[model samples]
Target: MAPPFAGGEEDEEARWCGLSTDMMEMILKHLPIADHISVSIACKSWRLATSDIILPALRAPWLLGSPMASTSLSWGFYTSSNGGQSLGLEIPTEFQRQWCCGSSKGWLMHLREPRNHSQYYEAHLLNPITGATVELPPFPPTVIKGVISTSPFATDFMLAALCFESTNFDKYVIVYQPRHPRRKKILIDNAMDIMFHHGRLYILTDLAELLVGVFDPRWKVSFKSIPTLFEEEGRHPDTYWGKLVESNDGVFVVYCTITTGAERQQLKVFKIKEWGRHHRIVEVKSLGDRTFFVGPFSDGVSISKMKSSSKLNIIKPDHIYYITGSEYSLWAHCMQKRHTFRVEEFKMTGNILEWFIPKLEDRSNLMVVTPTHSTSLLLTIIIVMLAVIGQCLLGWLSI
Candidate 1:
């Protein structure tokens, strides 16, 4: 009976399954990382091909047109991975003169200039991912204190917040501001600017008060002011734009105080752990006119310190770029080293620099400052123990 249909016959049957390698590749492309790993172990062919697949391309789509699209105002480009020079996409001429903020899902928010000083401001929302561009609704009419800033840093959501006072209360409310720049000009005041933390939104006002707002997906915004730690100093001398940064855990409140007849900018990082609120403040050299905390938090939680010197911004966690400034040099506090990128710094120039560093964007690639082999072994043991407890739940589910 043809040797009981064994060996060659079985091979023929497997071949008749008609699974083309090309079809397998296509199927594996859409699977999540965990599923991909699971599938590779099913057979030898998939194991070889899946191991060779490039992972980053599987990430969500983003804008990669031009970093220098604006003729009127220069723009900077940033991503979690090392952004290739070829990936830079230029903004269309229509968006050249206007202020634009780009979100994680490739949403571009631009403010169209008004015809007259008193004319209403116009804004548009363009999703580069879906290529859906539409005008936004008008925001609450208040004199928005400052311009909108967009962070390339990846978070749960791309956010925008504004700070304003209600005429009734001397206190200001930081609104969960949307990415509507034109509405900002019409409805919002200059006291507001966008700030994000641990996927939360905050309104940072000119008074140095941070009003954190929590909102639902329905666009119903609510405001809660983060009371200052300053001990009754009568409204702690106006904190500036460059002073606020979100750390690995919470937010770092930075402000320059005149102590003992010298200007000292105290970098105080606030972390909320199981033990409650904790503060870590350090006296560092040359607090950039503006610096963004980008990682390698001393703990398992990583934190990045991004500081600006001139047009060149030293974004910590690697992938440095000259986004805005006349000079390419930066006084990096982490490395405690000065770096210059030559003429590239002039590509985008300014001091009123405001932009977002997408949170944990390039986190994995960051050079973590870790301890020696002995300490690493200890950490590994702790991690393994934690993993055991975590996997136990999965094992129980299978039963």
Candidate 2:
């Protein structure tokens, strides 16, 4: 009996469809992280291959907007690659009324307010993609300024937060672990920003000092000052903000300065140099294809080739993309061009805009495939393939 659509054409189709699993995996590995879930659903073998595959570490940064209201469980993601379109992500119910303190390595630190006066506030880490949550111990009622972690997925990773004891001036840092009595507090003068780089923690102070802390084998933290990067110019005209970032080249401190009522913003990058007792910070004019994304929670530098396009809209190489407290307005300071511009595409109404890096990991529950999103991704891939095929066919006919 002959089956429907079974002919010489069917044999050719079958042969074409029988691509080796290894070949399919290699192809999938080169695709963007957004398309992984869609490709996995194409067949059983592809799904298995995706399950075993480890994605590349390079990814572009997405802007994560705050949840609309206390009742809303959805947050908006503004992707520059998609022409700055905002995508709505439905978070878990536990995050419905919480405040997002910080985000690092695909994890968000959220503080849940107490339902009543008798209960204390609780903080937890959430992976919005996988809807997995891990609760920390009760936190003091202080205001949380920022949070950073040494890879949230690891068992021994340390979670630290910069907090203010009161509205006046008392500031401190708290480190959290997964075990009981989960927090340790450290008093510091004043910290403007905190960052984790290469198993050590770096803190920037308002007085323009850089402090580095290292943990001993017994887990005791020892703090030391890095060489003075800047000298006080006795009442400078411009206000400065400092951020510590880790790039492929080395650790850098980015200082952004804006003169009062001036449209242009200035950026300075300094590389850290250490040779035994000699420590120095050298100013550099070029960032070498690295673009930094700076915010209150975390500051990160992304290489040019890692992004979808060499230039991310107005965000060019050697530029720093940042948001100010003035209604969460977006701005970029270009080191190469020596100019600053406002990114008007970001129609922000509130203050909770932060840079988010989407990670595709093997263990995260957030990787569960959603049918609708995967379908849209599949359609996009198909259209791209069709366009390529059309171009090839035209070329072949001409030849």
Candidate 3:
């Protein structure tokens, strides 16, 4: 692509500047993430196209400050896209004093003690990269971790979590839905992890059971036990760590196990397939274009079906980045090839590290600009004004 001011005929100029936004997006879709800035600089139309195409693309998750780096105040994270580089971001001063209890997909859930005389703590979702926050209702101290459904500013925003404040098997899952004055609770017990998938809440329990929660006119969570893989197949329960992840193939429970070796390269992955009451755990070799990130502090987030053009090439396809309960280190492993990359020095508080995806700047607050070119639109406007002036002069002279 030549510079915008390169010598060109009218036809060449038209060809470069006349492309419609849709056509520009089609071309930009094929280009790598690195070429987007160049395309955006080519012309106003391409800049519009770049904003349309890139805003919704998959963003790389941030490696939240290891727990050791975190004190009671002020949290930090690494972008990890630039081979572990820093992106300037601000964690609100108030949040610095709060606890970051939950994090996922560009949002962090913080719990703060009430400034007023209230019994319950206040919880809210904060997007550090965007400096936007959604005010949440007061929550009891029993709340553990939270998962935000979408952007906190979105119309359909919802928050769900596993709580300890409730009695066992009763109201263990708490949900804060849009347009609701108070939160809702679900009845489930021993929930190890909670995830929202296909418009339903899935809870994994310590006993290798699944609780599917549906919020219809009322909240109902159905339970199922799938232990044939561990009980019948003789796979030791202590040998693996499990979490639920969504894929193009559907939701599956990923059981990851680290084998004993000097290289520590062996990582096995398996999925659970259920039909009525019969459930079979199947070995999975590949995760396709999907990638999963799991840690002790947040729900397993699978950022899947990504475009090849994203700067997040560091996140390998079909690979899972996991942290076992006993191990504080992070490991990225491929199911089929068993290729592994381990980084062991991340000393987080309680050895916990949460994955965070940074949100773009608040679009509602950004100043929108109308594109104008001095050699194009501006010149045309000047010519039209000059013509109007000439016509008025001729009429005045005749009068």
Candidate 4:
């Protein structure tokens, strides 16, 4: 009788199965976020190796549109780089009916229906890539505007929501995950937008002053004011929209001006610099290699080193992609080139357009595998080869 490992085929199989866990992990880290879950289920050793591996950032932001009224399984996505290629994704039925309120850190905050129709609906954070959901406390039925969090995966996270009561013209900012039963609330008369950055919460008011709130060790909130560079521009407040963004350098406040009937729009960016004890706003004439994507619901910006690469068509550095309030039309304004282009291929009608970033979570599709599976090894090898080819193509195009 032949030995169990005598054949060349068996030897080859054993060699592949004997790959070190660390080696497997290093290889998997280079793959995209979408392939993480699929590769984790390949085999026992591969599954254990990728259990804690971090994924690389592969693609830029894709515009996620609302599902069509006819089909609950399909959602639309537009790639800005590929000349606005329209792609449809099949999502779960539960997400089809819900309304997307906000998105951050690769998670979408949706207003889901209540278990019982009599009860009030609650908001839940869903990672559309991994199908993981985190339930949040119930919110009021009024127009809840803001939802920003430091990170959804962290143990100690700060979440803030701005609820607007149109009847009484009251606006309240609710800070969540408090020790006591009642969360902290701050009342502002005309707070327009709220953003959280670097352990501080910023509120942009109608007076063009940035309100800075810092939570103490005991979670008590204190407020201060920072002078803005917009005051020096002498532009009308009604013509511009302000948003807070974090970049590689530091925090920046961007003001985008789009008049009702004007043909040209302007974007003014300021960097928040700290002196001895005061925060000074410095105006920047160029964005370098960073592009800002601003929307009504959520605002996000992306930075890329390969500005002239054909693969990076969806987003270019030193540009701004903004959505109009009434028409919901998407437009890209190049800061350096001083030109404007419309992303009319998507044609979003309603106020549901949002920028979505992709991420992979380990808790969702992790499963124990056994060594009896040999087919999984083939699939993993194929996937790894494809990923390598894709990366090479991207690098070649970048040159």
**Which one wins on TM-score?**
2
Residue-by-residue lDDT tens digits, candidate 4, 260-359: 5434666777788888767878888778878777666664555556243234355567887777645566787787877777765545665346676656
In candidate 3, which residue ranges exceed 4 Å CA deviation?
A: 1-49, 52-59, 66-72, 116-119, 153-156, 165-171, 218-236, 257-281, 304-314, 324-328, 339-341, 344-352, 359-399
CA lDDT, candidate 4, residue 354: 69
Give candidate 2's error at residue 384 in angstroms. 11
lDDT of 1 by residue, 150-239 (tens): 333323333342323456423232232443232221132334344455555554455555555455655555565554545445456544
Comparing 2 and 4 on TM-score, the stronger one? 2
lDDT by residue for model 2 over 1-399, one digit each (tens)? 122124685553343244446545555544664465345544443456566664432245777776444355455566644445554444566675677777777777888777676445788877665556777776756645545555566766777788886567677888765542536677878677777777678887777778888876566788888755666344433468788777765688888776654356677888888888655678888776787887777555555543443243545567777777567777777777777777775566563577777643524443333323354664564455445557668999999
For each candidate, the alpha-carbon lDDT, in order, equals 0.37, 0.64, 0.61, 0.64
The better-scoring model by lDDT among 1 and 4 is 4
Poorly placed runs, candidate 2 (over 4 Å): 1-58, 67-73, 116-120, 141-143, 179-182, 232-238, 306-312, 345-351, 366-399
Candidate ordering by TM-score (highest first): 2, 4, 3, 1
Candidate 2 minimal-lDDT segment of 10 residues: 362-371
Q: Candidate 4 overall Cα lDDT vs. reference?
A: 0.64
lDDT assessment of candidate 1: 0.37
**What ranking of all candidate models by lDDT puts the best one first?**
2, 4, 3, 1
Cα RMSDs, all models: 15.7, 5.9, 11.1, 6.5
